[model samples]
Target: MSNLQAKIKTDSWINATWSEYIQITENSDYQKAKFYYNKGKFRIEMSPLGNDHASDHNIITYAINLYAVVKGINLNGKDNCTYRKTGYQDAQPDLSYYIEDTVDAVPYGTSIISLDEFSPPTLVVEIANSSLADDKGEKKNLYEDLQVKEYWIIDVNKLEIIAFAIENEGSHRIRESQVLPKLEIALLEEAIRKTRQTNHSKVGLWLLEQFQK
Candidate 1:
């Protein structure tokens, strides 16, 4: 590609090949952009993550970890992890988890997890302050086709969580987690609401009390 013909920052990804998608994601301009490539198209998520988004991301992460510990469940979680299926599909979930019986799903020190080699995460989460639409539609299809057990989108603006259960290459809305039994979605949402009024330390303490009950 020549100087004038160079791929612009806002270039369309619809007709771009998988190699082109990878090249664009590697560009310095999109260092913070989350990437999702499925079928023949790619979507660059350049939404500026706001303070609320980051707060919910952190709280949910901590809450899940605390819940697992309190319940004696085996699980591992990742933030901003990339899972790629080579030329076919790729997803960079904001947070992902390998639940009990699959805590060691991916080996240590591996970068850019290749879905062709390893199993998909048991749970995937997208903190959706601004990207809720794509997170619910296109990204949902990506995770479903990737065969993740559960997918969640935390709507920061609405203080709501939209969970889904994936099976047979399809998904359906869910109210509670199928992988982490006894974990109430409502309680997590409640904790998210409390974060607006208090710090994570206090929110976390309250969560601990709730989980133990």
Candidate 2:
């Protein structure tokens, strides 16, 4: 990290000019940090992820993938893909997916996808471990503004999945997923619990049964 980047605050909102935010994102010093910009405020999440966060992230990814495959839903997922709307907004969601009709919307050889040129992800996820508050607050608004159809936050400590269905720039808590259709939130919560005592493969087997139902 350069002295300049070292001076920038991490994991908090900073009043930054649009140009500053863009420059910081392009800097190699903050490559690992998740970046967000909205209403002239910029945030860089530089916290080191722990085991619990990573575990939830992987399990959720696996669950989503398996559900899509079994149910034959057209899905293209991106882990930490950045999307920006020039001077207005930007976000690098922890997990992003283009579902059903938009599965192949983003073409090949694209880097740092521009929201102006392509449709935004239909679903966005944030594995909220230490950043649960921000995930539900500022990040929620961000996803809403991005117009994603659905947003999910996986709470690591509670082993809960909080899902929201976004519409008309507002979000409402939902127990079931609208985008994936018939994918129950409760089943995902159960799968996370089972992983504590069972191997991932066994947990995966259980998940398969759930998805098939």
Candidate 3:
């Protein structure tokens, strides 16, 4: 392994100081990679996203926005937004949101949201294609520690959503969103499944019908 890879392995968590983690992430070599840090270890996900990953990412983004709009819930969605808790923890979740009363929690012009200044996002989501295990394991723990109100893992292979409602630095499985109110986990899973058999517009129309009820 090169000096960099020796210090930090890609796709797996490794023990490192916060300074070491920052050095690795700042290097130009990993500009496009996703980074996560928690409890003195960090993960570098360098795997290039494939077609399946991209498709699911877009569809889920659409479904959440559509639902929020139809339900008249004030929402702000973040795509691959880096959230940092200074020397302690960091995450760039696939998707995140500030809902209703907290829609403007991070304010405009903020970069690499500082948890010291702003509360962690009310909801965080990771679309898990090849990284299902890590997303379910270490990453889930990371979000729990961050104290996000909700966390979701979309398993592309299974076309399923595994969601949790977080509190008191812990989490438990939940079928409906506590932050977004009546949004159901199974409904989102159904939307993902429909995307496999039809185009997004058709599925979107179906969602509109469902959300309108």
Candidate 4:
């Protein structure tokens, strides 16, 4: 096994230098992992492949896109995209959105988004199945530091969304999204609950009706 794999465990934070983190992430073994680096610590999340995790992730993405489209809000949605502040921080959120005027902030050919050159996404989301506590705690603080306008954690087991509006290096829990303009956290939770009883196609149709009304 490689030294990186020997010294570090996946799905948990490990103390490492920024350069070591980069090297481990670039190694082929972690090609599909989600990565986070903050405050001299880095976490390599082995991508969750369970059906429950993926189902919730798909529905949330569908709901957001459906809401944005029906509401005529211009947006660019990114799935598992990387955002970096060079040596300072790096995050690969499960889902993120650049909304309204910032929809085009990231140009077409950009690779890992450089936070120093561009503004952070208006919204960031993490789909939590096994990493719920980390998502709600350390990851939440990391997003605040990155100045993400809004952060959300979707708990797959509970079919719930805990959202926060972030500002001035702090955050407060919010029911209605400030970034997405009146998008209701409870509504999304309801949609996720519906998915437990039906397929995503039917849940998506339900979301369409809700967004239209």
Candidate 5:
């Protein structure tokens, strides 16, 4: 984080400007933090920074990276962008993946794309430590509307994973082990434990092995 980046991070939300939003959007360092405040062209609402517990955030991020590497999927970990669904909404899933095939299908330099525009991920993961209600409510509705193939919510306090999948045109139904059947629930539990004791890479490697299997 450079001095400028540090300043931007510390700056209050009231001082934010469109130029600052644009600059942060273009820069890689501030992607997650940037999306924390603005949605750019997207109209979706995001929970405030303090809404999510830090520990839960770290665990979810690790799990996503691990799953991506294991599956050879191009997971854009926390790169927030506006997607044009029925309406535009900005979302920063704790982890979101655009498989290699999906990326190859998109035209280069295209920013806003629709759910129909590309292949949906095998799964999308969110950690609900502080934003449990929002994750289960508004965010869930948003993902359903966008027609994401699968969604996972990690409840930090309960130490459980809630997974959902699109069942119909506008409906999403919750399921266990539906998205990544190969991934053992035990492994996710272990990953969450390791994330508390060490870096997320341990969980990442564990998930990579599952994908390799």
Candidate 6:
């Protein structure tokens, strides 16, 4: 209906192979749902979906807000930042955080930052339901390759959180506890549960207390 939406709609009509799509639109944002070449001939590539009901976006936002508030940590909530140069791929992590000290590393007031410009977040969280494979597979590889310090996969269906920490270059090892020792994993879990029950300010307060403690 709007110009931006119209442009996205138009781009969706162009039929291009994954390699061709990435090669042609390497520098620009071509928003559409299509498949791309990875290890095989093709892999389904698109923006993270936000369906009308039970969208991952809402769940991710809620979790991030809770985490930030409970931990009293400064974070930037960026969505749909294109992290790759070659591929019809763009990832909108449910929520991403750049900690207090590293805030100035990235330019301010920008929603989209190039993957090469700044170091990866202390933590990157992906709320998974249907796109679990992509989050755990291709995107997991992407973030690991980018050298993100930590990554979290939150499964809404199962209400479980799995975290991965990078050990060596391009290697991710699963973590069983909060890397930030001051913050309790149980508190985070409780906040997540509260978010699912009701979007409340208490989650934020709980996070702040953890930071202060």
Best by TM-score: 3
Tens digits of per-residue lDDT for model 4, 1-213: 256568888888888889988988889978888899998899999855699988888999999999999989999999999999989799999999999989999999999999999999999999998999999998998999999999999999888999999999999999999878889999999999999899999989999999888
TM-scores of all models?
0.94, 0.95, 0.96, 0.96, 0.59, 0.63
lDDT of 1 by residue, 111-136 (tens): 99999999999999999976788888
Error of 1 at 97 (Å): 0.5
Ranking by TM-score: 3, 4, 2, 1, 6, 5
lDDT of 3 at 64: 90
Off by over 4 Å in 3: 1-5
State, as a TM-score between 0 and 1, how close model 5 is to the true structure: 0.59
- Distance from true location, Cα of 11 in model 2, Å: 0.5
Question: lDDT (CA) for every model shown?
Answer: 0.88, 0.90, 0.91, 0.92, 0.56, 0.55
Q: What's the distance in Å from true for residue 197, model 6?
A: 4.0
Clashing pairs in 4: none
Better of 5 and 6 by TM-score: 6
Q: What would the per-residue lDDT of candidate 3 be over residues 1-213, giving only the tens digit for each residue?
A: 256566666899888889888988888989899999998999999998898899999988998999999989999999999999999999999999999888988878888899988988999999998899999999999999999999999999999999999999889999998987899999999999999899999999999999999
lDDT per residue (tens digit) for residues 1-213 in model 2: 245466688898877779878889888878778999997888999988998888878888999999999999999999999999889899988899999999999998999889899999999999998889999999899889889999999988899999999999999999999999999999999988887788788999999998887
- What's the residue-level lDDT of 71 in candidate 3? 87
Instruction: Evaluate model 2: give its lDDT.
Output: 0.90
The window of 10 residues in a row where model 1 has the poorest summed lDDT is 4-13
For model 6, give the 10-residue run with minimal summed lDDT: 4-13
lDDT of candidate model 4 versus the reference? 0.92
Best candidate (score: lDDT) = 4
- Report the candidate with higher lDDT, 1 versus 3: 3
Q: Considering summed lDDT, which 10 consecutive residues are worst modelled in model 5?
A: 36-45
Residue 151 lDDT in model 1? 96
Evaluated at residue 172, the lDDT of candidate 3 is 94
